[model samples]
Target: MSDTPQSVSSHTALDQLRQLIQQQAAQQPLPGERELAERFAVGRREIRRALNVLEEEGRIWRKQGKGTFVGPAAPVQPLMLHDLPQRSNLLEVMEARIQLEPGLARLAALRASGEQIALMKRLLERMQLIALKDGDQHELWDSAFHRAIAEAAGNRLMLGLFDAVDAVRREPGWQHLRELARTADRLHSYDDHHRRLVEYIASRQPQEAATAMREHLLVLQQTLIEAINCGEEEQL
Candidate 1:
């Protein structure tokens, strides 16, 4: 179901250690996970995952609950990697957001400051208040909520990437589409999702936070796409 954290951790020791394992491992079995972890100066989790990667690639085999051994290499399983897209179209923007934000939320769950999470909670409260009263402040608070999550990620690059997408998201036409999609009828659901995202991040459950963020964006993406296809005068 939720596999985002493993994917997130795959980059660090997974790549370097994998290459080392492939190059060094030949006819002999490799060192146990503890030895590998000490040699690599990484956590057992990283070494374990690196071994899992090799096993998946058919470059290594694990004997039930025992040691891992080298095997003839097979076709590699392509690792999931990403870079921000240059396109600013709605579909492209949404796709980019989907790719980056969930991971960012995962990072935030691991690293977010208490103060930052509190700020996000305040922003969520503001949105609820705006929902109650007929007002234009909802958009501002919504934007703040996302930016807060980006800040909570504690990665400058992640923050910058989020800011870039958010800038495009503020474009008048994009704003209009979002307004159309995020209608009064669907606002409560949106609020609930946002609440869940904040709670997960605050609770420090990386996979749950990532999944929550992914689900939230997917709903937004679907709503926005439908609105774009239907035109402004139409209500969905």
Candidate 2:
């Protein structure tokens, strides 16, 4: 706890602070930086770094006029752009998503509220109908559905990660590939896949939910790559 984030090889202070916050009375604002620094036997810089980590992970949020407080387990907002320049790195974006989203699904399995699950179910049903209309609104809800799952995972950081990934997902090229990938059969499967993922979350099976999401993303990745290659072939 005496070390700065640079001096420390691990996030010990961050973990300690996170656990300490959990021990406090629910919904209570944590003490200011100076008090937490004194209590943890760490510098204020280390305490601030730990607080940033907690904030990103969705465990906490700070109000500008007020103090830091715990965020809702299921946040209402769907996205936050991380201010990164957009690039044509569609595969790389999908790679990052595969790495993060399954873990969120796992957390949702353990923590999702019934209301969150119900929202997901409604989104799934709507996506099926919207898919038939062939509109961008469906894709918007596609991102929303995933954001809802991330919120239900009960982690603030995952929501941020999903937000960054989703902002890139809105890029024109990626959107084109997504539309191309949605064949009649694949779109049908998409509904089914969404249903299965929600079912695992509803049933409270973490591993199963993770597996369901991982498999779904893998299929999506393959579809995107195939679409990209096909477009290249057509150009030649």
Candidate 3:
């Protein structure tokens, strides 16, 4: 389906006003409220109501003499995990993550704002710091890193999906993979992929972002498969 339009009348009006601001940003500020009301087929009261909502939402700014303009939208709120699946299996987590993460990355590449990209950069730096401090806490940081990216995608629903997968972060196989994945060689490779994906997103290269995302997951999948196979061999 196409992206849902802003539904609440005030919200929709705010979005329309924002779009107008964007279009006219370099040229001139928008017309006065009376003109906007006429243009949108709404009364002046309705325009003022919409502007009030937009102001509260931080989607616009207004000066006493100058007139109203756009504001930076609010940063996305953190997602909470509740009513999600209670599984704690590593294979299940990895499989679900592989299914969901790449698409989110691709969308982020297409839709991410400057604020979101900055947040992602902060997360990457934090991940690097954690890796340096703890040496090989891949299970914790890797899962957090991915979830942070999903959240930065500005899609709360997908963040919740990733959270459900993350709930199994302490499973034995997950720990095993983290241990195996902690080596300097793998860490550099993994971090490289993460950086590349973030860069592609910042550059608004959806195809490259999607490719980087899939490649990152494939590495994890291959590692997990090899680990499972080796375990089976030992068992046999």
Candidate 4:
């Protein structure tokens, strides 16, 4: 049977909506259905249909009371170690990342979809551009790139743990240390690490991905330690 006009329109709307979602930051809320309908010049039914398709693909998630958001829904339970960040120092946070993130990269190599790999590429490019044009925003994009890999690993529990450690890394003192550690030479090295890590994941080489991530984190840890020691010496 020939496809109905409405069904065809809905399919087109679905493609449009997917592109729109790709342009948005992960975890960003989607506009309401009515707003989306207006924006896409489609009926509300068509908008709902497109949203349903996206939800099934894990591109968007809707909460009954809170509207829709980009990316897969997060685990409902918060991390139990709410006070851990306050008590932690930069070294501790690096320790946690070195332990956790390589596993994420390995899993991502094993599990990431083609679309997810493409997103990682886009994020890497964005991070590089930010490093050149807007140095301060580099950390923000860098975090997003790593979070994308963690999400692609398809482990909610591990992602929750990642978020916990990430929260600690975001503390003002930790951010300062990280900023201090990011000399131009180190930034260039980081860019190389990011490229190799993404390539390994894209090529489905789990061990290589894991090794690249571990090496990258170890370098970051060493640099941060140096930054902290330098700060102490200057104060003495």
Candidate 3: regions farther than 4 A off? 1-88, 130-139, 232-236
Best by TM-score: 4
What TM-score does each of the candidates earn?
0.60, 0.65, 0.57, 0.69
TM-score preference between candidates 3 and 4, better one: 4
- Write down the lDDT that model 3 would get: 0.62
Off by over 4 Å in 2: 1-88
Q: Please write out the lDDT profile of model 3 over residues 1-236, one tens digit for every residue.
A: 11111112333344356556545433345579999877876566557756754454345778889987666633332232433334344566677777888888988888887876876676577567655444323333455457556766777677666654554443333444445545566667888898998899999998888889988988877877777677667779
Kindly give the number of clashing pairs for every candidate.
Answer: 0, 5, 0, 0
Q: Output the number of the lDDT-best candidate.
A: 4
lDDT of each: 0.68, 0.72, 0.62, 0.77
Q: List the residue pairs that clash in candidate 4.
A: none
Model 1 steric clash pairs: none
Model 1, which residues run further than 4 Å from truth? 1-87, 132-135, 232-236
Query: What is the lDDT for 53 in model 4?
Result: 49
TM-score computed on alpha carbons, candidate 3: 0.57
Q: lDDT rank, highest first?
A: 4, 2, 1, 3
Residue range 1-236, candidate 2, lDDT tens digits = 11123323123355456556656655779889889878767777767756754564456789987998875433433343534425447788889989999999999999999888987887787688777563443554566678778888988867767866776665543445565676768878877889999999999999999999999999999998998998788789
